[model samples]
Target: MTVDIENLIDGESKFVSFSEKISLPDAYSVNGDVLVKLSGKISNEKKGLFHFSGNIVAVLNLNCDLCLKPFNFKLDFPVNELFSRSIHKKDDCLSFSGNIINLEPVILDNILVNMPMKAVCSNNCKGLCEICGHNLNESDCRCEKEHINPKFEKLKALFEESENE
Candidate 1:
């Protein structure tokens, strides 16, 4: 959705409320849709700079990094940004030239930044067994598991002997 900044600037409106249902494209692999809510107030911070500050709330569907299980992640945070008719190299802000502002990227970027680097269902997730590539959380393996490195057998024997003593 696009916010018509030019219209807002020229009018007497001081604040704006926006809500949108955003779904990622099939090629962009996030699990589910996002509901983004933004309420911002427009202010003239400097001579002509339009500063917008607001709150953004979103629910993102993410997956467990290790087990690849889907889960819902909630994001509620503040957004402080500047929208300008031209680019400002030194200032930290988003550029908008025309009447339209494509807020999708801004909303998406904010949500993504809050995403966990390593998402897990829980701390106790058993995860997949390294030896047989079996999902330990789902089931157990009955077949005797071999050591990843054959040389570890001697060390295993030593450890067993120590435990016996």
Candidate 2:
């Protein structure tokens, strides 16, 4: 998305808002289309410097890490960016060539930075059964429950002896 600032004058601010469905490139394990809603105001602070402050809201489709189920995650955050029309790009501000400022890069960066490391459908998700590879949240599996690692067998016997005493 690009913002037009050709008619904006110095010391003047414009209120811009838009709701668009954007297809983000597959990134950070996020796939499919996203609904992005941006509402902000852009102000020309000086001759070639602009300041934009507003909020960004987006809905992302993600899969649960534990259950492997697809779900929607909503992200809402504040954004404050500086734009400059200088020939020499500075490390602190974003540089633009013409009277338009590209917002896609900023939006993508914020979304990726705020993405969760682990996604879960719910807090009490049971995940999948280890032996039968069945979704334990739906129903219990018929696999044997007494299977224990040989390394932990001695520990289990010690606990049993202590309980008897």
Candidate 3:
């Protein structure tokens, strides 16, 4: 995604919009191409400084962390950044050389930063059963419900004795 600033005059702002599917090969968790929609304004602040302020709407295909099921995740966030023609050693603004400013890097950075640490299909999702590796969301597992570690055997005997008395 690139925005043309050749016609933008100093102190003038132009509205920019883009709707496209972008491939995110760096995003390991993303299952497919991301649908990105960007709407924002790019303003020429000075001779070489420009400011871009806008909103992004993206749809990502991801797998649920719990059940490993595929799902669509929607992300909406605001972006405000600076672009400069000259590079500064300690500057945070992105540097651009030509009249066109590439927004792909900015969009990718924002999407990655805003991504959730854990992706869950739903709050009530039932994960796979540990013993049989069955999908608990689809059906119940026949594995024993109560399981105690060997280290807790003494504790279990104590509880049994107390119950008998």
> Which one is best on TM-score?
3
lDDT per residue for candidate 2 within 111-151, as digits (tens), equals 88888888988899998887788888889998877777977
Kindly list the per-residue Cα lDDT of model 1 for residues 13-113, writing each as its tens digit.
Answer: 46768887888644233755667788877665543456767889876676766667776667789977776665553367777665666667777777667
The TM-score-based order of candidates, best leading, equals 3, 2, 1
Per-model TM-score, in order, reads 0.67, 0.83, 0.84
- Ordered from best to worst lDDT, the candidate numbers read 3, 2, 1
Q: Pick the candidate with the highest lDDT.
A: 3
- List model 3 lDDT by residue over 91-140, tens digit each: 87899988999999999899889998999888898988888888899999
TM-score of 3: 0.84
Candidates 1 and 2 compared by TM-score, better number: 2
Residue 82 error, candidate 2, Å: 0.9
160: Cα error in model 1, Å: 14
- Alpha-carbon RMSD, each predicted model: 5.5, 5.1, 4.4
Q: Which of the two, 2 or 3, has more TM-score?
A: 3
Candidate 2's C-alpha lDDT? Answer: 0.86
